[model samples]
Target: MFALRRLSTVALSGARCKHSLPDLPYAYEALEPIISRDIMTLHHQKHHATYVNNLNATEEKLSQAISKCDVSTAISLEPALRFNGGGHLNHTIFWETLSPKCTEASKDLMVAITESFGSFDAMKELLSAAAVGVQGSGWAWLGYDPKIKRLRIAQCANQDPLEATTGLKPLFGIDVWEHAYYLQYKNVRADYVKAIFEVTNWEAVSKRYSKAAC
Candidate 1:
């Protein structure tokens, strides 16, 4: 499986400090009707910013614990590390996977999808289904299984990072958190999940797939 590097920079105060929120690639309203400006604004500035903040804080504490040679304390921080770290990682991919502009699936990516799922439409349907099927706050992902050399649709509960939990390199992800679509789609998460395809940045996903396939 491809190694999913930690994107967040860790710098403790007594140790070192540089983790910051990543700027959105486009304006808040770029996705237009597919995703509302209010949704984008809150999702990125508030929700995602919270994750970054929490991750930095968690890392800071972990660093302190490590410095004291407190293995027990460091071990106790696993939940925070997994949750906040996964949140940050998932959001990073989510933001990049979506675009205001429509993007075509690359030939290689399309071939993989078709081979694995019968057709592009079939794969899209399955991915959408997976997203809509999430029980709670979770994600649906198009991930590459390096072992079988297959493209797969997987669902993850809570903020579990795709690669970390499943060892599948994530190509694209659809967040099912209420914070992601509650404003626009309301309780109709399926609609939101289906509509997300319109704004999907397939070019970005294709590039991720290319790397994962390698």
Candidate 2:
């Protein structure tokens, strides 16, 4: 329920703060039958933790660059900052937006989804297409457009954060990276994307929508 600390914000600060991997809310096996224990274990312990570590390192380098007035060096580091920072932010939200229990979307969220895409199922179809269509490692997201007061489906390449890249407040996201599903789902990305909904934490997504829509 906490907000994610974006890499941009962290880099702009005068002081450097070490980023740590947020612990999974449930055990590795909690999401099983949908996402395997081995996948979750590696995803959290190895992949996500790597991002956190790299983000911390990137921020340190950025701080040094800024202190030394090395604007060129700082600019050169932006890609690393975006990649690692986005990875941390994205995965943190991803973990929170999934659960082992079955839950339904909140009425308000469903209404919004219907209003935006004609129906909830239609929205899912669109989002699924976007997720599966990602050319390589990336994510598909259901996000809220604050200015338009509507929900939107979008995709980002690599670890590009949706908000940072597209100005959309993320409601829910599907990580389409090979590391997310390759071990169990193999090259069947669509199947993995579909099964993810089985563990989708709609309630958590609803809470995010409520805040973003406000």
Candidate 3:
């Protein structure tokens, strides 16, 4: 029985090694009437899943190349690993930082936001504009700036992780990827940005802020 349990653990870890998608904490339809069920399902199961899959595959190759000391092969795989890995990481955080209702921001989170951006409303305006004004596929993030000891809103193109690119710890992220909102809000990304507030998981965000500060 001990041996069997060990094998099961190995199997589970191996499965995770291949970049399996993280399960959503809530149902696909839970974020309605902000995000549609169809969009959530496809975005999570298809788009985000693909990134996770590709990242895992790329990492496997990277591991093999590194173990074999094949510098050229490892170098060639860097772009793929960075892009897909960053996508998976960012989306994982994004999913957790949202819910299905307009929950109040945590008091601690509110205090942080106020300290960083002057007020929650100010933070909202800046984050919303940053998200909606993204020229193409990208993400807008509320990140902790260690240097300044404050939160800041920033944007990144493609699948670049906020911390890797800007040295900020990501507290929350808005996926401006068209696939995130195209099915529901079409080309009007502003509508999606506006609606996202309803499902913003401020409690989770507050915890991240606290951790980052520490």
Give per-model TM-scores. Answer: 0.92, 0.93, 0.90
lDDT of each: 0.90, 0.93, 0.88
lDDT of 3 by residue, 1-214 (tens): 7787666555544655566799998999999889999999999999899998899788877766665558999899978987999999999999999987656767877888999889999999999999998888999999999998988999999999999989999998999999999988999999999889889988888888888988
Question: If candidate 1 were superposed on the true structure by all CA atoms, what would the RMSD be?
Answer: 6.5
lDDT per residue (tens digit) for residues 1-214 in model 2: 1233344445467456678999899999999999999999999999999999999999888887775668999999999999999999999999999999857999999999999999988998999999999998999999999889999999999999999999999999999999999999999999999999899999999999999998
| Comparing 2 and 3 on lDDT, the stronger one | 2
Q: Residue pairs in steric clash, candidate 1?
A: 11-16, 11-17, 12-16
Model 1 TM-score? 0.92
Worst lDDT run of 10 residues, candidate 1, spans 1-10
Among these predictions, the greatest lDDT belongs to 2
Instruction: Give Cα distance to truth, residue 186, candidate 2, Å.
Output: 0.6
The better candidate by TM-score, 1 or 3, is: 1
